[model samples]
Every structure is written in C-alpha cells, then in structure tokens.
Target: MRVLFVAAELAPFAKVGGLADVAAGLPPALARLGLDVRVAIPKYRAIGERAQDFASAGTFPVTMGGKDLTCSVSQGIIPASDVPIYFLGHDPYFDRRGIYGEQNEEYPDSLARFAFLSRAALGLGPALGWLPDVIHANDWHTALAPVYLRAGAVDLMSRSVLTIHNLAYQGWFPIDQAAAVGLNEAGRKLVASGRQLNLLRGGIQAADWITTVSPTYAEEILTRGEGLEDALQARRDSLTGILNGIDTSVWDPSTDPHLWAPYSSTDLAGKVVNKRALQEALGLAPTAAPLLGMVSRLAEQKGFDLLLVAFERMMAFGIQFVLLGEGDARYASFFRDAEQRYPGRVRALIEFSEPWAHRIEAGADIFLMPSRFEPAGLNQLYSLRYGAVPVVHATGGLKDTIRECDPVHDRGNGFLFAEYTAEAMLEAVGRAIRLWRTDPEAWRKLVARGMAEDHSWNRPARQYCAVYERVVAR
Candidate 1:
C-alpha cells in the first residue's frame, strides 16, 4: 500500500505535543510492515535548520477561498529512517515564530493556514509524481483534507483516513470563513452547524475510516465527544481505537544517554544512582523516600486543577515530588510555592526540557499522570519501559494500559483510581506507597511486569495496516 501520512507536527523538525511523536513514530512502523509510506508536513519557519537539506519537488497550485495559491514542495527523509517525507513550503502561511501560535495565542488565520495545509498536502503527491493510494490525515490541523477529496476538488481516487487525537479541539470557525477551506456547496453543508463550520465534523463524515489513540479512548469519545457526541455516536461502528505505542528505540532506558546511569528491570541498582543524581541536580534533599516524578504540560486537561488540591494531601505521604513541564500560570505558581514550602521534598521545574524528561523517566521510582480526560498518554508507556510504576487516573488509555497492583497475588503493573476526585487518586497513591514501603519483592515484581510488556509501535502499526487494507478493500 502507498500511504501518505499528513500532520502538523513531526518530531525533531516540528513538535508541539504527543501528536508530533505519533507523526514521527507511526510512518516508520508502517514502512517496516512492507508498506510504502510517506509523510508530509508544513515547512514552518519554526522548523529550525530551514529544512535546506530537502530537495525541491517543484511547485503546485492549491485552490482555497476562491483563490489559487502557489505552494512549493520539498522532499526529505525521516530521521533514522528511509521514509521519504515531504514539506509544503508556503512562506505566507507557515513561516511564523510558532507552529500554532505565539506566546500561547493561536494565530487568527489558523483556519486558512491549516486549510491550505490540507489542500497543499493533497497536491504534494502529484507535484512529486508519487500519488499515494491512501491519504492519512491527523488531528484538526489537516481535517479538511477528506472534505476536499469528498468534494472531488482533488483529482485523486485515493481513500482518506482521519485520526482524531483529541476530540476537544475540532477547529470550529465562522461559517463565512469556511469558504476559505475550498469545499463545494454540497461538502460545506456536511460541516455547517448553526452559524459555525466544524472542520473535524466534515472530515469525520467524509473519511473512509476513523481512528483515535486508544481503545478505551475510542469508546469514551462516544459520550465525551466535547460538542460532537451525536456525530461520533453515529459513526461509532466505523471508528476504531488502537492504543498508541512509543518509539522504543528512543524511549528505551537501557540505552538512553540522557540518564545518569542506564538500568533495566533485571539490574535496578542503577535506578538508585539515577534517583540520587536527579535529586541532587534538582536541589532536592536526597532521601530513601520514594521519588515520584511527573513530566507533562501543567494544564487543566492534564489534571493540574486536581493536582493543585491533591498537592497538600500528597505531602503527608512523605514522598519527594519532582515535576517538569510548562503550562497554566495558576499551576505554575502553586508548584513554585509548594517547592519553597517543602524545601527538601518538592522540586518543580516549570519548563519543557527533553533531557530532563528522559532523566525523570529513568530516575523516579514512580511516575504520575492525573489527566482529567486523556485520549492516549505517552508518558505512562515511557514510565513502564523505565521501570517507574505509574499512578494514573483510570480513564481513556490510562484505563486500558495500567492494571492495579495486586499486592496479594503480584498480578498488576501499576496503581489506578477510577473516580476523578483527589481522594480517590490519593487512595491509589497510598496503596502504591504501602507496597513500596512494606514489600520490596512485590514492588520489584510490579516494575518488572511493566518493563517486560512490549509497548512498541510494531503491533499498532500492523493494526493501522489492517485499517488501511480494509479502507482500500471497501
């Protein structure tokens, strides 16, 4: 199968969140499965190095808003792989300081920017003389791709697959602005709602197949579909939720150079060395108390709203806490205060550093994820690989991946709390702590179980291939 995967972010080149990692990891996995896969992303100015290495694939016209805008194409290879990736070079739209915004503010012309991206991605294949059989568009950024294809504006017979990363963000815009996306009258009606135009709604209705990050998350979207619950429920039979897999090659603890010392499930002595190193590096008092680490955006969706309340309650557990991420001013202020209040026990770095993230995964005894509504989480998978037991809210992918630690039978991998309240989460955390303080053998078994499980992209990639085949067959 010839597949063209399109997304707004591609790691090492342009990355804003988990979507970048998915764009980076999935195509290569699909390539390994004996499929011809290529990737396309906007050539943004934020993508440092200017992508000068990419060979030009000539120019093409993308019609949108009743105007034919010219876009140049550049072809390059995915880092560490032979997958041919393409870039849509349009200085007016993508040449900006940020991928989606500047200083947390989204670009006002985001609708036009991404709509151009969708149409340009469709034209890229023919510009390079490599038309794909399947066009896989990701998230709200490229949601209009399927819409244009359905309108037959593009002269391709290929099927399209739209993957919803987060249902909360559907790119709702003024109905007047919807004309800029280059959809025909018939296609426009599908996405129009009251006075707004829902880009994702159109894609969901037009795409041959739909997928989300995780199986449980897939089901959750039926009711938790933000504002489009009815549309999702109508398409429930076609939507498949496949759990996302991390890039084991990059996330593997045994070989990661960012850690103080490499460690595996078999030899945990290095884990102790890493813990002390990280504690000292972060200026936290080095103690035998279990070190709990969290690396995520400190936004409301990530459960910072709940963590703010749970912070004081968790301090009583006598565990050292370390957080590394940047989001929400309220959460940042709170953590900064907590760090000062508990000088020796708490350390919060309100920033995003890749090296620190890897170090936290490798060094911390327990990893924390308390998302309010997670579609699919990547850090828990990283934690599992690094032998860091996870204490996550039992929702979406967290519910699918983590199993409660069975202290009696030694059966589960980590701790889970079903209720969204802080007390429920603390109860789960208390259980993990009790096992860590009382039973060393049980703790080791729990860590070993998580570490031993394969969370690589190979399986998920195969599952995607099945979806693509089914789409093609239909």
Candidate 2:
C-alpha cells in the first residue's frame, strides 16, 4: 500500500505544534510495516534553514483564482529515516519567517496559501510518477485536499482520508473566496454554510474516512460540536478515533541527550541530579519541595486561566513551580508577576525552547494539565514517559491515557479529576503531593509503571494502516 501524507508542518524541519511531530513520526513507522509511505509539506523559510540536502525534483503549475501559480517540488528524506519527503516550494506563499504567522494572529492570506498547497500536493504525485493509494490530509491547513479531489481536480485512484487534529480551527472564510480555493459548483455548495466557507466541514463531507487523534476526543467533538458538531454527527458512520502515540526514540529519558543525567525506571538517582540542576538553572533554591512543571501555551483552552485562579492556593502547599511556554499576554504577565511575588519558589519562562522542555520533563516531579477541552494532549504522554506523574482533568486523551493512582490495587499511573475546576485540580495535586511525601515506595511503583507502558508509534501505525486498507477496500 502506498500512502501520501499531506501536512503543513513536519517536525525537526518546520513545526508549530504536535501536527508536525505526527507528520514526521507516523510515516516512518508506517514504512516499517512494509507499506510505501511518503510525506509532503510546504518548503517554508524555517524548513530551508533546517533540512540539509534537497535537489529539485520538478515544477508544476497550480491554477487558483483564475491565475496559474508555478510550484517547485524539492526531493529530500525525513531525518533518521529513508522515507521520501517532497517539499512544495512557492516563494510568495511559503517563504516566510513564520509558518503560519508572526505573532498570535494568523496570516490574512492563509486560505489562498494553503489552498495552493492542497492543489500542489495532489499534482506532485503525478509529476513524480508515484501515485499513492491513500492521501491522508491533516488538520485545517490541508483540509481542502479532500475537497479538491472530490471536485475532480485530479484524476487519480487514490482514496482520501481527513484527520481532524483540532476541531476548533474550522478555517471559516467569506463565501465570496470560495472560487479562490478552486471550488467548483458542487464543492462550493458542500462548503457553504450561510455566507461562509467551512473548509473542515467540507472535508468531513467529502473524504472517504474521517479520524481524530483519540477516541475520547472524537466523542467529545461530536457532543460539544465546537460549531461543527452537527456536521460531524451527520458523518458519524465514517469517523474513527485512533489515539496518537509519541516517538519513544525522541522521548526516552534513559538515552535522552538533553538531560543533565540519564536515568531509567530502575535507577532514579540521576533524576535527583536533574532536579537539582533544574532548580539551579531556574534560580530557585534547591529544596526537597516537589517541583511541578508545565509546558503549554498560556491559553484558555489549556485552562491557564484556572491555573491563574488557583496559583496562590496551589503555592501554599510548599511546592516549587516551573513553566516553559508562551501564549496570551494576560497569562504571561500573570505568571511573570507570580515569579516576583514568590521569589524562590516560582519561575516562569515565557518562551518556547526545546532543551528547556526536555529538562522540565526529566527534572520535575509532577506535571500539570488542566485543559478545558483538549483534543489529544502530547505533554501528558511525555510526562508519563519521563516518570513525571501527570495530574490532568479527565477529558479527551487525558481521560484515555491517565488513571487515578490507586494504591489499594497497585494500579493506575497518574492522578485524574473529572470536574474542570481549580479546586478539582488542586485536589489532584494534593493527592500527588501526599503520595510523594508520605508513601515513597508507592510513588516509585507508580512512576515505574508509567515508564514501563508502551506509548510508541508501533500500535497506532498499525491501526492507521488498517484505516487505509479499509478506505481502499471501499
């Protein structure tokens, strides 16, 4: 089976979030299963700077908005793997400093930019004489690929699969711009809702199969709708929810290069060294207080507002806090003020740094995630692998991945709370703290169990291959 992945970002080359990580990791895992898998992404400015060797494969013209835009295709390989990676190079659309935008705001021309990308991705296969059996499109950025294919823009035997990474971003635009995306009469009708063009909705309506990152997320979206729930419900029979898996090779604490000292489930002495090093780096006095780490965008969806509400109360438990992420000016300012208020106990770095992220995962004793509505969170998975007990709200992937610490039965990996409230989060944190301070043996067992679990891509890859086979069989 030949599979072509259409995505906007690929990790280690161009990344804005977990979508890039999935794009980079999934194809290779699929390749190991004896399936021919290839990935295609835009040749953004960052990708050119990071990816090493690339020779021009060919060029093609994409007709959009009554103009023919020339697109260059560059051939390369995914780092550490032999899977072929094709870059669609169009300077005006892709050669920018930021992948999507500079600040929090999205680029105004994103519709046109990604519309060209969807068209170019479909055209590239024939240009290279490597047509795929399945074209898996990801997120709102590449949602239009299925739409274009449904509109007969490309004559291929490929079946289209649309993966909804996040339902919040539906890519709604003025209906007048429908033609700009090369939408035909049927395509326009499929995407039109009132006076807007809903790209994600169109993909759900057009694609052979629809999938979300996790089963719980898939169910939550249908219930909450986020606006497109009705559309999702209408296509319920076709949708499947497969839980995402992390690249264990990149996240294994025993062999991680970014750690101060390597440690495993057996010997946790190195974890102690890492904790002290992290405290020194963050300018907090090294103490026995449990360190709680958070790496997330400071946004309402991530429940940063709840963290802000519970900050003072949470600090009263005699714990050290370290956060590394940047989003929302209000949350940034609040966390910074928190550092000022509690000089030796609180530290916040309002930026995204790879090394710091790995350090927090390896060093911190507990990780916090209190999302209001998470589709599928990656940090909690990373925290589990690093033996940093995750205290998360019971929703979506967090619900699926984490089980409440049950000392009586010697089961459950981390802490979980059902209510999305600050008090509930504090209660969960308190339980983790109690375990850390009182029952050292039980805490060790919990940490060991979390590390022993398999969160790699092997299982998820096989599930995806099954989806591809089902789609082709249709």
Candidate 3:
C-alpha cells in the first residue's frame, strides 16, 4: 500500500512532543511490514542540518480569505529511515525560530500555517505523480487535509484516516477562514455551529476512519467532561482507539549509551549505579532513600499542581525526589520553590535536557506520571524499559500500561491511582513506598515484569496498517 502521512512534526527533523516521535517511528515500522509509506511535513526554519531541500514540485494555488496564495513543495528524507518526507517550503509561514509557539503562547499564524500545509500535501500528491492509496492525517494540524480533499480534490479519491492525538487541541479558528479551507457548501453548513470554525470536527465528519491514541481515551471523549464530547459522540461508531506504543530500540536502557550503567530484566544491579550517578549529577543529598523521578512538561494537564500538594505529604515517606521538564510559569515557580524548601531531598530542574531524561529513566527507582488527562504517555514506557517502576494516575495510556503493584501475589507491574486528586496521588505513593521498604522481592519482581514488557511500535504500526487496508478496501 502507498500511504501518505500528513503531520506537523516528525522526530529528528522537528519535534515538540510524542506526536513527533510517532510520526518518525511508526512509518519505519510500517515500512518493515512491507508497505510503501512516505511522510510530509512543513519545511520550517527550525529544521537543522539533517533537513535537505529538494527542487520544487511546482506551485499549488491556495485560496485563503478570497486571496490567491502559492505554496512550493520540497522533498527530503528522515535520516536512518527509508521513508521520504515532503516539505512545504513556504517562507512566509513556516520560517520561524521555533516549531509551534513563540515563547509560551502559540504563534498567531498557526491556523494559516497549518491550513496551507494541509492543502499543499494534497496538491503535491498530483504534482509528484504519486497517488497514495491512503492519506493518514494526524492531529489538528492536518485536520483540514481530509476537508480539502472532500471539497474538490477528487483526484485524491484514496480513503483518508484522521488520528486525534489530543482532543483538547481542536484547531479552532474564526468562521471566516472556514471557506478558505476548501470546505463544500454542505460541509460549511454542517460546521456552522454558532460561528466557530471547528477544523477537527470537519475532519472527523469527513474521514473514512477515525482513531485516537488509546481505547480509554476513545471512550473518554464521548463524555461531557471530555471537552470534545460533541463530535466524538457524533461519530461514535467509526472511531477506533489503538493504544500508542514506544519505540523500544531508542527507549531501551540495557544498551542505551545515555545511561551510566546498562542493565536489563535479568541483571538489575547496574540500575543502582545509574541512580548514584543521577544523585551526583543533580546535586541531590546522595542518600540510599528510594530516588523518585518525574520527567514531563510542567503543565496543568501533566498534574504538576497535584504533585505540588502530594510532595508535602510524600516527604513524610522519607524518599528523595527529582524532576526535569519545562512548561507554564506557575509550575516552574512551584518547582523552584520545591528546590529551595526541600533542599537535599527534592531537586527540580525547570528546563529539559535529553541526557537528564534518560538518566531519570535509567536511575530512578520509581517514575511519577500524575497527568490530569493523558492521551498517551511515552516517558512512562521508557521508565518501564529502564527497570524503573511507574506511579501513574489511571487515565488514558497510563491506565492501559501500568498495573498497580500487587502486594499480595506480586502480580502487578507498577503503582496506579484512579482519582485525579492530590490525596489520591499521596495514597498511591505511600503504597509504592511500602512496597519498596517491606517487600524487596516483590518490588524486584515488579521491576522485572515492567522491564520484560514489550512497549514496541511494531504492533501499533501493524494495527495502523490494518486500518489503512480497511479504509482502502471500502
């Protein structure tokens, strides 16, 4: 099958989150499964030496706000992967210092920037003389691709699949820009919900198949509290939620060059060397107390606010804490205060470093993920592969991946808390601490179970291929 992947970010070239990891990782896995897959993303100025510019595949006209605009296409390859990546080289839109946001806020031209990209991908298909059997669109950025194809790009008669990474970011815009998106009159009529340009809703309505990152998340979106309940429930039957997978080759700690010691399920003693190294590097007190780690964006969605409250309660357990990430000001200030108040016990880095992230996964005895609503988490899987048990809030992929440690039979892989509250988090941490102190054999068994678990993209990629085949067959 010839599959065209339309995304805003792909790893190595440009990456901001898990979506970039998926864009870069999944295609190669699909390629291994004997499918012809090619990825297309914007040729943003943020891309570095790895990005190579190709000759333009001619110009494609885009109608934006009744104005004619031309977009040029350039092609490149993601290093190490055979998959070809097409870049929409429009200097006016994608040429910027960063990928998505300026500082903390999103750039004002996000709508137009991505809208042009959606149209450009469709326009390039014909220009390059390659018509894909399936067009797989990702997130709110490429939501309009299916919409534009439905409008008049009939040459793109191949079926389309739209995957929602996060239902919260719906790519909303002004109603005036809706027509410029190439929606038909009927399409416009269906989307005129009190003067909002719901780009994702249009894609959900247009695509042949719809999918989210996890089964729990697919069900969550149908609820009123989910924030995108209206459209999710509107297209209930078509949506499939396949849990996201980790690229085990990159995440595995046993052979990772980033760690101080490489260890696996069989030989976990080397993990302690990693822990000692982490304590020295982070300037922590360097105690034998179980080192708990957290690596994530310090945003409200990540449950950093809950961590702020739970840490005070958790301090009584006598465990040391370490955190690494960059996000909102409130959380940043809160972590800074944690550094001051707890001194030797709690160490917080407000900025993100890739090496530090790997250290946390390899060294820390336990990893914390108290996300308010997680579509799918990648770091937790990394921690599992590194022999670090996870303490995750039971939501989305966290619910799917973690099995709360079973003190009785030692059956569970990690610790889990269902309620989205600070107190609940405290309770779960307390349970994990109890397991660490009172039951060494049980704890080691849990660690081994997590390490042995397969969090690979290969299975998920095959599932995606199945979806593609089904879409094309229709």
Which residue window of length 10 is worst by lDDT in model 2?
46-55
Mind giving the per-residue lDDT tens digits that candidate 1 earns over 201-297?
9889888899999999999888878888888888888899999999999998888989999888888888888999998999989789999999999
lDDT of 2 by residue, 1-474 (tens): 999999999988887788988998899999999999999999998766654578778798888878899998888888888999999989998889989898777889999999898888888888888898999999878888998888776677789999999898888889999887788898887788889988898898889999999999999888896788888999999899988899889998999999999999888888899999999989998899999999998889998978989999999999999999988999999989999999989999999988899999999999999999888889999999999999999999889999999987899999988988999999999999999999999999998889889988899999999999999999
* Candidate that scores best on lDDT: 2
Clashes of each: 0, 0, 0
TM-score of 2: 0.98
Per-residue lDDT of 457 in model 3: 83
Off by over 4 Å in 2: 50-52
Off by over 4 Å in 1: none
Model 3, span 219-332: residue lDDT tens = 887894245577678789889988888777777777888889888899988898999988898888888898899999888899988987777778878998988888898888
Q: Give the TM-score of candidate 3.
A: 0.95
Cα-based RMSD of candidate 1:
1.1
RMSD for all candidates, in order, please: 1.1, 1.0, 1.9
Candidate with better lDDT, 2 vs 3: 2
Candidates in order have lDDT scores of: 0.89, 0.90, 0.83
Sum up the clashes in candidate 2.
0
